[model samples]
Target chain A: MPLLDWARTQWDRALGALAVLIGAILLLVGWMKISDTGFVSEQLPYLASAGLGGVFLLGLGGMLWLSADLRDQWRELRGIRARLDATADLAE
Target chain B: MGILLGMARLHRKAGAAVCAVLGLAIVPLISADAQADATYAAVAEATGTRVILTNQSIPLNVAPQLQGPTASAVQNSLQQSDAYAAFPYPGEEVAGIPGVVGGAAGVPLPAYPFVIATSFGDGAKQLSYPGIELRAESTETLTQSTATGGSTGAGGTSSARVARDGDDVVAKAVTDLDALRIGESLVISGLHAVATASRDSAGKLTRASELSFTRLSAPGFVIGLTNGKFTLQNGTEAPAQNDVPLAQIAAALSGAGYPTTFQVPQETPDGIIGAGLQIQTTLPAPPAGTPGGFSGETPVTYTIGLLRAEVAYTVLPTTPAAADTGVDAGVDAATGVPGAPALPTTDLAGLPGTVPVLAPVAAPVAGIDLASLQASRAAVGSDVGWIYLMVAAVGLAAVGGCAVLYRGAR
Candidate 1:
């Protein structure tokens, strides 16, 4: 199957890949910005923030790609338990 | 007492023998030192060197005014021109007097003079007018071989060798000074060397003598008067018509008591070439009781353009030949004399066999410094390596997490 078709069937994985791609692009942009800035000591903070943000996005994308469906199922279970408690309170 | 007398006599005899040997050795050393000093003195004398300056009057067509934008443009053009490089002179010094106005003595002056003062009226009495003095100089060298007679050394061996001699010629332009004016322009166009030669240290012909000529032009300006009363204008406009005939300028200069008839030698001597112009003028003096304490009757301004060409013939001393062992006698027969000029060859048909093979030396590559290469590599590794590693790690983690989720779902 074509990779695009597979990504359509598995949207979570595709979203995770897209997030990772974005992170990689951000990292490349950060590197280019730092190089253009001539590695000035005053610009280190901005470069560090950009690099950290890219890493965080990559981690979030990876987690979402892996367990996005599982996370939705856990939310549905919590909602069912809350409805059961409300029905018992009405019977009392 | 007899033993003591005998010992003292023996000591005196030994000391006298030592002194005699020392005197014999010192005599040869002193003689050799004196001979070397004499040889050096002869070389330093540089005898029979000749310097000649032949002046050829080159007529001026139009005197271009050097002032304002035109002056600046000409200066820029001269700076970038090859003539300026060939004959480099101080343009500022050429235009003004050294140390009289305000410039370091011996420094190269500008080609144009700076205007110091200006005044109006015909009777403005001034001692002198600010005028330009143009000077140009060139130097060339030639070498000639002369056979020196054989001189016997201590061993009675005849040392016949060739000696080189240097001849120098210096040519300068001469002009009379009665036709110059504050706003007048002067242009000299032709100056060159008639002949030149170059030879190697061995006195062998490297470059033959050739006849050649160089055209050089030096334009000048006269700015102001010295007594601070006469008006002098240094504008860009030509003092005379741009298309004015050369004969007319010559006539006016002649009427003003300046030499207009410039004569040229029927034959220019070898290694000598020069050209220049002379201008002279008498400005009317200020009337009696004029302001600024003026008292001169009539001040005359005389300017001359001097172009000099100097040629130097340099001869390097003969280097001593290495000692010849018995093994080189056969080689000497084929090579002939050590410092003799090589015979002309008509063709290269026998060159493949006669030519000696030489191993080529390795040449260093251009534009590649090892230190810079290493530094650049280190910079790329440090700046870009971590980003690539982070991206790779994130990609692998995402792939692994996705695989685990798929398995759990199954």
Candidate 2:
């Protein structure tokens, strides 16, 4: 039970780290492609989209890392709501 | 564990949304890149040798008139003579007829006959025409103050100032004169003028008066238009004149009209004279069944007077060898002509020179080489690719930031 609890606590952090790694890899690949092709405005739109994707990944990772504790709080709120519903049903 | 699963599920959904938006944005970019590549290929193809030949006919109508003091004398003499009293004004009707004037010995005045003739070169050929007569249509005289011996606005009381008087007169002819042809030079002589100058008590020049006799010589011009055939005057052969393409002549006519005056040497008997010629084009609508009209193909004839010669020029594109011998090409190695450099010849034993030693010449480069052109095309392609990469980088960063914020809110 203790190992399961530990795994639950660390899962969001693990996901956040994975997202950050993927984002960084995407950025590296985009830069390499640009350097190989040579820089001009014709290729701007594609490069822009790839860069936006990388930024989104980075932001998602950061949020996941920052809100690891918030996930626990959300779970607790759901549990409390369920107990309140059960009590209400008994009273009825 | 359930909460962790829920968070993972939300993250997956958000990632999927971001991917979808990014994919949609990239579709247009890919199409744009393809279009740009096509344009670049077209440009590369267009970089080649191109030759253009333009044939143009220029119509020039010039009537140069010589007018001054001498012409006024002839006009006054003719008007005052009693023999010409029957008709008040003498012009084209009495142009060639001689009129006798009384008072001093009888002087004969030919109203329309040319007073002067000019011959070029060895005097084998000469052109003669009468001076266009000028009847005073209108005259205006203006007087203004001119600053003399003083700086403007100096306000110095001791500065000496003098009032200067000037007269400007513009005169028009009563009737239009005949058109003059190219290669015809005529002088309108017998024009006389007298000028008198007046000074103030201090001997400073104040006023000047001039009386001039007007004699006009209309300048000659010829417009030659030739498509395939040319017709000459019955008794005359082609006069000595420059032959230019008909299109070029037309362009000249379309441009500004001929010069107001023909340049004359200062020492010439006529002196400096002001001349002007007017050209009116009378092109009727093409007749029915003409090529330009609703139908047919019989060549239409246009008769433009005062033309010396009609000619045409056929232009052909230069072959590779022909192009190589052009002015742009270096000196010819065989003939040592055109742009060939001359080197000093050293003589041995001061005797007659042996076979002349020639300098080595570089071989001429042919038409544009494709290798350099291809390299430029590649450079442009590479630049376009780099721009795409840069835009993608920026876009990915922005999207990543938005995604992070969304997750944080969740």
Candidate 3:
């Protein structure tokens, strides 16, 4: 499936990736602004705001993506537990 | 199946490492500033060995050379001094008067009783009798191959001073003053010219040639105003204009009628008399058909002025300190130098006065120093509250996103 179509089905993962993309763009723009500046004082603000903010959004997106993965693993484990219980009942 | 999973995990790690390396590489692309662009343009304009700084480990080193108005203005003033130093006195050879440290003296023959100071540069400087005073000062960047060298050194200052004291005429030109070097190569060629003449009250010329020259040498071949001869390669001189002769001054002072007897140097002296005039000889050919007088790369034409004088008068000081005053002051500092005008910081599209390049990956930022950075930061007192605020906001957003993910998974 096209990534966009898959993302529509998996909205959680899509939002996480979108946030990461925005954060990366913000970081790049901030870096561009800092490069044109001469003084550390001039660059510090960009580093703090955009730089830190971008990192923050990245971490958030990673966590959200990780949570979706864990949820998938939990669903798989629950199906296995149900099947094992049904077999136990048949043996009994 | 377990082995396949382990191989897939290794591949993912390798892919992440590659992505990290690519992200780091993007830093250099964002580091281009206006000065770098200007320096790149200048190098592209000049013809010679195309120096490319590819090996980031090996730093390219070049002795900084003066750029902009200060250097050219000083050169112009020195050229005028050469004219005076080369002035032909009937009985005496005007030797040592137009060299590195000697001044160029003697008013042009026609402009008797009234001294005329002629300099071919930007803006016309005129001096009238009975308080004749003329002073010009300018500053220009001592730009190196900034694109390759990756840094520009401090600027140089040049000044021209012309003053008349009774029967005495004094003109001085001092260039490459207060020059500073950034890199290892210390190549500085400074020119000083001072011409002073004293005559007895009786009006008969007593002393006409008073000159001194100072020369500082580095290890390599230096090209500048050497022995009153300016070598021009790949450049052409602008014709001299606005010469105020004694007749014009006499007409202007006709009503005032200051009766003063002035001795005119002989109009025509034996030998070539093109002093005080600059010429542009054809490239790769001997100057005026004389053999072995010029040397420079092809396609780079430098104008040679015949005149040599050393008058030190600062017109506009556009050094970093002076530049901090305002944009107008910095632009106005380009009052000298015909072709080489001062580079105005205002044209950098609202960037900081000096748009120093960020260090490429592992190197220090090319032009900006630690002391200046700290000083600038302390002076500006940048408000970083927005940074903290954004961090907090993002942190809260991440927590909320995490909660939503957990509920969806459940």
Candidate 4:
């Protein structure tokens, strides 16, 4: 049971990290899709600025969603670990 | 598990690859800036070279000039050669043309041999040549013997007349009515011999019918293919190799494995003439690593205004006024008829001595140096090939990403 709880905790952390990375990737792709040929036409200065904004927003959205998953997974892992610990103590 | 490491490397490379591609894009842009002017100049230079090379040839035309002495002399020689049937004038026809008065019965080489005795004479100059005549020729020799008082031999009409002399006929020169000079003897070989017993009303010595024609043929005329040029109607040769500064542009194209045929459009002082070189090729797909049998015909085309440029030519000989005239009447009647004035009696028929030439080449000039322009265009194609490489880099990146995710999961 303890092993099971440990495994769940690891899974939760991994999934949480994955979700953050995936969200970041999705946002990057979405922003790039919207940039269009105009971004290049205006030259590097305008392009660089556009890239900064897009990247920032995408990163924020990604982190925000990942944090939410982390929170939920952490709660579930805590519940599992607590029940497992209590059972272990009673067994002893 | 090692694939995870590879994926990481691959991902990074993919990012770098995109940067590299974007970097390369600047290459064409930069090269274009640096080489555009030079390339076009090269094209023009090459074109000019081609034109000059083709145009500088010494034209070929047979010029004929006989002085008063030579003319009369030739006329006398014709009269003496028993090989020819007599006519009042050298060019007068025996049968006679309805309206045209000049021309005569053909005597094969009898008249053509005059060229040997009187080609270029005093007081004659240039002949506007279609081209020069080829020389694979023959000549005539005089034959006869002096008979003492040959003037009154056996016949009332000049005694030089003999009954028979075995295949050897003689030209008895009648210097005047009473005086006679024996010319050299002419051994008539390979001549068809015919005999006819002439019978008057009683069939007595009405006289052996006498009159024979010898068949004659001369080597056909040949025209050279030296430095052929395609001339356009606008009086300009298309695709001047050196239009600007690029010399050896055509040679360069040849080096690049381009087929020798291409077209170039040219803008002359008058207007634009499209010109181009065309390389015809035959490619056969055979078994792996083997070349197949192939044949090809490659010709370049150049269009300048109304005229086109390409190599062409024709050959022909002057027609004899009569069948025995030894003139080749119909040779290159197709290339286009030349405005030639007929000679009075000789194979030296037309005054131009050249066939009517219409080498209006089929090719029109395309804009400029074709090979060089093509080279630059190829540069563009190469740039595109690089873009495809970038696409490949992206594919590798995607695969790397998948590998990374899989490994991380493990």
True contacts kept of each: 0.06, 0.14, 0.07, 0.00
Between 2 and 4, whose TM-score is larger?
Answer: 2
| Tens digits of lDDT, candidate 2, B1-410 | 47657866755575656546555655544543321221100000000000111112212311112211011100000011000000111222232345433223477454433322111111111122232221111011111111111122211000001111221111111111122222123222122211112221121222221211122232333332122111221222342244444344334543433222111111111011111122222223336655522322212111111100000000011222223211132333553322211111111122232111111110011112223433443454323443544555454555555555555766
Candidate 1's displacement at residue B247, Å, is 11
Writing each residue's lDDT as its tens digit, candidate 4 over B1-410 gives 35434644543454344335434543443332110100001000001001101111123421111110001111101111111111111122212242233234333222322111111122121111122111111112222111111123211110111111211112121211121111111111111111111111111111111111121111221111111222111222222332221223333333443223322333222112222223212223334443332223222121111111110011112212123322222322343222111111111113242211123221111222333433443443312223323332343344334334434543
TM-scores of the candidates are: 0.20, 0.21, 0.26, 0.16
DockQ for every model, please. 0.03, 0.07, 0.07, 0.01
lDDT of each: 0.28, 0.29, 0.30, 0.24
Looking at model 4, residue B394 earns an lDDT score of 42
Q: Once model 3 is optimally superposed onto the true structure by TM-score, how far is the C-alpha of residue B203 displaced, in angstroms?
A: 49
Task: Write candidate 1's Cα lDDT for B160-269 as tens digits.
Answer: 01122321122121211121123234322211111112222222222111111111111322122111111122343222223334455456545545434221211111
Off by over 4 Å in 3: A39-45, B1-410
Assess candidate 4 and give its lDDT. 0.24
Give the lowest summed-lDDT range of ten residues in model 1 chain B: B69-78
Candidates 2 and 3 compared by DockQ, better number: 3
In model 1, which runs have C-alpha deviations exceeding 4 angstroms?
A1-92, B1-6, B29-182, B185-277, B284-289, B292-299, B305-410
User: Among these predicted structures, which one has the highest DockQ?
Assistant: 3
- Candidate 2: Cα lDDT at B336: 30
Model 1: how far is B343 from its true place, Å?
46
* Candidate 4 displacement at residue B300 in angstroms: 32
Give the winner by TM-score: 3
